[model samples]
Target chain A: MIYFDNAATSWPKPPGVTEAMVHFLEKVGANPGRSGHRPSVEAGRIVYDAREAVAELFHAPDPLRIVFGANATEALNLALRGLLRPGDHVVTSSMEHNSVMRPLRALEEQGVSLTVVPCSPQGFLSPPDLEGALRPETKLIVLNHASNVVGSLLPVREAGQIARRHGCLLLVDAAQTAGDYPIDVQTEYIDLLAFTGHKALGGPMGTGGLVIGERVPVDELEPLKRGGTGSRSEHEEQPDFLPDKCEAGTPNAVGLAGLAAGARWVLETGVEHIRAHEVRLTQQLIDGLREIPGVTVYGGLDATRQTAVVSFNVAGLEPSEVGLRLDEEYDIMCRVGLHCAPAAHRTIGTFPTGTVRFGLSYFNTPEEVETALEAVRAIARANK
Target chain B: MSYGVVLVPSTSHAIRAERVCHLAGLKVKLIPTPRQLSSNCGTALRFDWEERETVEQVLRANKVDYDEVHQLEW
Candidate 1:
């Protein structure tokens, strides 16, 4: 069976990921920062190493600013709900996942003004359009680095500069591009970056975080939840320091151990190499699918402008039917439906029924892509 | 023997100090925060008083957020 739905969650993670988690469970099984014992110290070290690894991946200045959470959704919530107050204005794009859209919607209802700039039919946002939407009251501009549905990359660097010019903070949702592409928070002038370890980072689920930049005044943003951070236990008020200021409870130490190893692997192997491999596979898949009759592919054919995700529709069949056929007959795994980004589907004109998504990964080979394309061709022929 | 205790304001900083010192090959032991020290963190790093300069240098280089370093009789 071929697995191609990496956008949802990556499969068959790097060998070191599971090994590291197991090592945590066996050798360093203690709550980090909760005790002063040797095991606890070792556990704290593992967590810190993961923080440093995440910092290195994003080129963040300080490791202490990396705050751990359950996933990108949680991280986004922390950033959106934490930073934006009533009467503050925000600018975002139409091609955002529910992770960003839901929180913004909730914030909008709470009297916070929101302006959603529409993306092109191909799911690319215009940086100038984003800048035009910003108001004097606009305190933040949040956007995803890449669309989860169409795989089109946004102009984050330009948007970051615009945000800086307007005195608004730029918060990037790097859910799909964190490990697959190179991102330097400093170079891009990003103020906050939210990422998930389970996807491109190749770690176990239940691990993700937000990396805060130096420009953001963290003290002003309220934490999503507050409790014992194993520091300032004597004081009922939460600690004002970073990491602890955002991280309120016992963290997912086991998952983080795996994340550290996964991040280390990405750094050692280099993101450029991974991006090249995925681009090659994506180009092959897109080219093959476009050649097949009755197979209408979405998104641009440019491999350099997108991640490995490709969406398509076959003639005379619903997306669900095609997905079922691919799974039962071809033994190929992919995602179908709106993909949690209804706004993206609307932008691409696949609103209700959605489309079949084949998200490639670094581990996927050209041979696998070829086989999947053949399966798609056979399905298209049958539908015709 | 005289020992040195490095007190930090938080557990995260203490953990960071330990890691920085350990990587630098400084002989440091993470012990409970002594009653004499007024710190919020539960743990503190204990090292030889003679190695104060070395520990300070390593922590400073690593940017480990520490509070105070005191010389105590053991």
Candidate 2:
């Protein structure tokens, strides 16, 4: 059986991910930073190691600047809600996942003004259009590194330069590109980077965070929830620090152990190597799908311009029907429907019907792509 | 031997300090912040008082965000 739903969460994680989680649960069953015992210290060290691994992967300046949370959604919420206040202006792109859209919509109701720059029909965001939407009160600009639906890459670095010139912060939702793409926070000028461990990072679920860059003001950012942070227990108020100010609960140490191992594997293997492999597979899939008579491919259709995800639709076949046939007959698993990014689908003109998405990963091979393409071709032919 | 403890703002900072000390060949351990040292009930990095100067230098070079330092009787 071929799995094509990696954009949701990667499966068959690299070696040591599960073992590290098991080791944490079995040998080091302790609440990290909540106690001063040896096991507790070891647990804290494990979580810190995860932070360091993620920091090193992204070239972040300090591990202390990383705040652990649930996933990219939670991190995005933290950055949006904590940083933006009433009367603040924010700008975003038309090609954004619900993670960014929902928060901004909610913030708009709370008196924060928002401007959404329209993207092209191919799901690419133009930096000039984004810069044109900026206002003097624009406090931050949130962008997704890549679209979860079509896998089209956004011009984050250009947006970063625009944000710099405008004296605003740039926040990138890297849920789709964190592990596969090379991102240097310093070079990219990303003020806030939200990443997920369960996706391309090859870690288990419930592990992800926001890496706060130096430009962001910690004093102004508020915590999503208030609780014990294993620091400043004497103070009734929260501790004003890099992570403690944002991290206020017992962290998922077990999940972090797996994340550390997964991130380390990505580092040792090199992101460039992974990208090269995925590019080959993505081009093969896109070329093969477009060759089918009734099948219509979506997005930029250029492997060099986007990620490994490919979206398509067959004439006279609904996306759900095509997905069902691929699973039952071809033993291929994929995701259909809006993919939680209605805005992106609408930008790409797939709106209501959405499209069948095949999200590839480093583990997917040329053979898998060929087989999936053949399956899609067969399904398209059957409809014809 | 009496030890000198380096107080940090958070557990993340304390763990970072301990890592820097170990890398510098200075043996250090994280202990509960001694009540006599500070009111902050967080982790503290304890080291031999004789290496107090070296500890200060290494932590400074690494830019570990330490709160303060105090010598504690063992």
Candidate 3:
């Protein structure tokens, strides 16, 4: 069976990921920062190392600024809900996932202003359009580094410059790009970066974080949830610090241990190498699918400008039906529907009924891409 | 002998203080921030009072952000 739904969640993580998690559960099963015991200290070390790894991956200056969360959704919630207040304005692209859009919508209802800059049909956002949307009241500019639906990359550096010029902070959702692409928070001028470990990071579920850049005043952002962070136990108020300010309660230390290993693997193997492999597979899949009759591929054919995600549709057949056939007959796994980004589907003119998405990963090979393409071709032909 | 406490503005800085001190051969232990110190953070680093000068130098050299260092009995 071939797995191509990496945008949702990566499968078959690196061996070190499982090994690290097992090691944590078996030998260092203790609540990190909750106690001063050996196991507790070990757990704390694991969590800290994971923070360091994530910080290194994103080029954050301080590891303590990286706050652990359940996933990118939680991190996004923390960033959006924590930073935005009533009457504040925010600018975001139309290609955002629900993780960014939902929180912004909720905030909009609470008197915050929102401006969604439209992306091109191919899923690219213009920096000028985003800058034009920025208002004097704009406090933040949130965008996904890459569209989960079409795999098109956003010009974050250009957007960041615009945001900085407007005195607005940039919050990037790196859910689809982290670990698969290079992101330096310093160079990109990002204020907040939300990433999930279970996706491109190759970790288990339940591990993700938000990296806070030095420019963003940590005290300005409110804590999404407040409770015991094992620090400031004597004080009822949440600790107003980098991570503890955002991280409340006992963390998922075991999952973080695995995440650290996965991030380390990405660093060791080098993101450029992993990206090259995925781009090769994506290009092959796109070129092959374009030749199949009755098949229409979305997004540009340039693999260099996108992640490994490929979306397409077959004439006279629903995407769900094609997905079911691919799974049942060809033993191929993929994602179908709006992919939690109806706005993106609408941008690409595939709303209501979305496209069939094949999200490849570094582990996938050329043979698997060929087989999946052949399956898609057969399905498209049969539908006609 | 009284121990020297290095209070930092954040937990990340406290952790960095520990790392830099260790590399500089100054023995330091991370503990809960004493109530006497600022309530800005939860974690603080404790080291020997004799190593206060070296600790300060090392942290400064390593660019660790710290609040203050107090020579206090623990």
Candidate 4:
């Protein structure tokens, strides 16, 4: 009954998340920004509130600059596809999720040159190595705040400084760290940050966005899709201002209502406190798994250096088999396989074979970690 | 009791304008954009015309982007 797949999506969301969505559906079910009616304005308020909450959480310059999208993947696409053009050079780390890699790979085919700075086998990206990958035409640098596979933190702030010195913008995919980590766009010099609400943000799916910093040229960044933005209806072309510039069509107001509540919960329960709790559980899980004779642990193995996710493999058993036994026999739910980050798997030396990942959250306690560790131990022993 | 309307880029801007105005102790409401103001189709913040200068100043102080401010007859 224990859920360890929080890196994919959090479960048992904080108190008001479900209630807010229910309230929106029951009382204020209306399309946001599409109409001028009272209910429409009210729904718009909910969506705007979600933007403000997400903005405040990241310490972004303005809420209006926070462009809403379906999830972090879409936001990453908006940043990568909107900003980069043919002949433009971009640099990224090898420890990136498919969200960043796939878009960049597609861009590479469209004449944009890409440089993937290799990370260590432990999935750590060195800032110097990243800076070395930059070219004269390097216009942007995209990096994940943390690796989704091993949960190893990247040197985003250092990379940001390097990017700024090179006259390049830094785009951070914070799918793994947002809400769970403290990120100040201004202080960190992050030009663009993509985040997800379903993961650590504790909200419903289909709610996430990108925070566009002041350095980005709004005029040049193109919209992913263009339609009625509920504003500038007279114009056949898209509106130049954000977020309407990036956001087109009716938004997911109900999902946003839940996002606002979930973000508020994270704010009330300070990120530092949440980070500390997750660190404790992560360290415990790592230590216990390493103690098992036939279990092979991955990543930095240091709680202070990474997130709550721990990836491992049992000897003589495939990751899929281990995952199935954990689910049906042990009643523990987790994710296995490449985790949609083949590049990261290659960096961590787990490509193709993959690994069993236990992504913990603030809601997970030491007791749950202990039980999961015992389950892993039993499985490993049986395989041995 | 005439009212002044502040036109903004989008509904998100209008919502921000209303929030900042309310925090500044000025009463404001989001109303349908009057056709005469601009061709942009979105909501506008309606406030007491007497507080026109104050509303403008508050919006500027709060960095809320507004297109134009006009006195409404309706």
Candidate 5:
């Protein structure tokens, strides 16, 4: 199967991922920090090693600041819901996942105002446009590192600088870019970063995190949950701290173990190489798809501006119908519909029907790309 | 091995549990509060031990207490 719907959740995770999870469940099954013993200590060791792996991958100075969650959506929820308050102003872009958009919209109930900067039709968000939307009351600027639908990467460093100039925090949803993209928290001045392990990271689902940078002051935001920390079992009140402030229960340790393994694999393999591989595959698909009559490819015209995702439409086929056909006849799997980012699709003028998105990954091969292209050609010809 | 369930009232309360797990060297997991178990927090921690009286002692010592310790099998 030519599995192209990786933006949703990557498939065929690294071989080591499941092994790591099983190892943890079988041998190191213990509640971290809930007790003091060999089992508990071993559990702590696993979690700590995971943190170190993440810290090393992202170049994050502190391992303690990396807070794990079920997925990027959950991490985004924690970052958005925990940090924003009534009367606060937030800025976002047209290219955000519903994971980021939905939570911010819910905050409207709290009187939090929002400004959504428009992106170029080719999927580029103009930092100047966002700067124009900035308010004196703007407390946070949320930017998706890459659009899940089109794979268009945003200019985060410039936008982060603007947020810093205004004393506002910059929150990045790195769902699509985390493992495939190299990011330095200090260099970009990003205050909060949310990443999922299921996508480019090649980890299993239910693994993601929110990185709280040193610059961001999150003290005022309320904890999403409160309970007995293994630390202060005697205290009924929940602890108010960074990871503790936002993290409220036992983490997804099995998923985290796999995610850590994935991150380590990315580090050892190098994101640059992964990125280069995807670019090569994407370009091949782009060239091949363009040759198919009645196929209209979408996203930035330049290959450098986008990642491995390629979105396009067949002239005569309904988006969903095309997806079904691809699966049934061509054995090609791709994502159809709004891709959970309606605004992005609307911005690209592909709302409702959305587009057929083929998201490539390092594991994909040149032969797979050629097969998908041939299948698209055959499908396009069927329309004739 | 030490065993306990660290219960929290809301989903957000797990952060403290995460901290305690990270700092105290415990294996922590976030599970929906088992309907059988009642607590102010809806999430509970399924700890990693068959027995550790000293683990409970440290929790009590550090003022980090739990709702109950059910010597449940893993």
Candidate 6:
């Protein structure tokens, strides 16, 4: 079977990822930082190494600021809900996944105002729209590094510059771009960033985290959860530390181990290499899919303004029906429908039914893409 | 065996969901949301089969966000 939904979650993780997970379960099985025993200490090291590895990958100056959660969506919630309060304003974009939008919408109902900058029909958010959206009450500018639907890359550096000028913190949801691109918190002036491990990082499904910049103190944001953080057990008030404040209860140690391994591979291999591979694959798909009649491809029509995600709609086929057909007929796996970013779908003019999204990963090969292309051609024919 | 699954969009939401679930006398194991179901999010909560009604009560009361619930048979 050919799996093309790497943007939602990448399967067939790197060799090191599964190995580390297996190694952790077999060699070390203890709650980290909760116990000072040798095994516990080792487990703690495993978690710390993953933290450090993630910090390095993102070029974050401090490792402790990295907080782990179940996925990027969770990390984004901790950053958004925790940092802002009543009367505060948030600036976001139309290209955000529901992970960013749902929480912001919840906050909006509770008195926090929100400004959603418009993205192009291709799902590209212009820097000027973001700049114009900012207000003195705008305490945060939250958006995605790449469109989860179309994988269009946002001008975060320009947006970051604007946020810094306005004294508003910038929080980027790197759910689709992390490990696939270079994110420097120190250089970008981004106060917060969230990434899921199962995507570009090639970690286990449960792995994801938030990278808190040194610019934002942990106490400024309210603790999202309070429980045994393996620190300050006696205090019922919750531990007051960066990771401890945000990360509650036992972490997905196995997932972390895999993330650590995946992160290490990313660092050694370099993100540029991954990007190069994806660009080639994306161009290939575009070239191939463009040949098919009655197919409308979405996002960065230029091909250079996007991540590896390519979304399109075939004439006369429901996105769901098309996805199921791909799975059944071609043994191909792809994600379809709104892709959780209803706003994005609407912005790209594919709302209601949405489009078929093919999330490309570095691990996916040209031959696999060719196979998917053939399947799409056949499906389009059948639909026509 | 019957199980209750708690649905959350992000891991952070799951963390809070688990707190609410535990308080509801429901034990939740974080399982990949059964893909047969449709969601904008990726995770789900599975609980004791017998305590489905109780878990649902807790989830609804605390507003522990969930997309859908299912009874998985073993």
Winning model by DockQ: 4
Better of 3 and 6 by TM-score: 3
* Interface RMSD (Å), every candidate: 1.2, 1.4, 3.6, 1.1, 10.2, 13.8
lDDT of each: 0.92, 0.92, 0.88, 0.92, 0.79, 0.82
Which lDDT tens digits does candidate 4 get at residues A1-384? 999999989997989999999999999998888888999999999998999899989998689999999999999999999999999999998999999999999999999999999999998988889888999999999999998989999998998899899999999999999989899999999999999999999999999999999999999998899998998887899999999999988888899999999999999999999999999889999999999999899999999999988999998999999999999998999999999999999988998999999999999989998999889888887776
lDDT value, candidate 4, whole model: 0.92
Clash pairs, candidate 6, are A74-B10, B2-B49, B4-B46, B4-B47, B5-B45, B5-B46, B6-B45
TM-score of chain A of each: 0.99, 0.99, 0.99, 0.99, 0.98, 0.98
Model 3's DockQ?
Answer: 0.31
Q: What 10-residue stretch in candidate 3 chain A is worst by lDDT?
A: A33-42
DockQ of each: 0.67, 0.71, 0.31, 0.77, 0.04, 0.01
lDDT of 1 by residue, A1-384 (tens): 999989999997976999999999998999999888789878988999999899999999778889999999999999999999999999999999999999999999999999999999988998889999999999999999999998999999999999889998999999999899999999999999999999999888999999999888888989999898988788999989888999998999999999999999999989999999999999998899999999889987788999999999998889999889989998999999999999999999999989999988999999999999899888888766
Model 2 scores a C-alpha lDDT of 0.92
For model 5, the superposed segments whose C-alpha errors exceed 4 Å read B1-74
TM-score of 6: 0.83
True contacts kept of each: 0.60, 0.69, 0.16, 0.73, 0.00, 0.00
**Could you give me the TM-score of model 2 versus the true structure?**
0.98
Over 4 Å off, model 6: B1-74
Ranking by DockQ: 4, 2, 1, 3, 5, 6
**Candidate 5 chain A lowest-lDDT run of ten:** A227-236
lDDT of 2 by residue, A127-163 (tens): 8899999999999999999998888999999999999
Taking all chains together, each candidate's TM-score versus the true structure is: 0.97, 0.98, 0.94, 0.98, 0.84, 0.83
Which residue segments of model 4 deviate by more than 4 Å? none
Return the lDDT, model 1, position A10. Answer: 94
Candidate no. 4 TM-score? 0.98
lDDT of 2 at A70: 93
Instruction: Write model 3 residue lDDT over B1-74, tens digit each, in one string.
Output: 79998877655566667776887888899887777876555667899998878889998887676777888886
Docking model 5 quality class? incorrect
Give one digit per residue, the lDDT tens place, for model 5 in A1-384. 888888888887876888999998999998765654556656665766677677777788766678887888888888899888889999999988899999999998779998888998778898889999998999999999988888898999998899889899999999988888788888988888888889888788888888889886767766667765554444677765555656667877777778878888888899898888888888888888888889998888456778888899999899898899889998889989888999999889998889998988888999999988888888888889
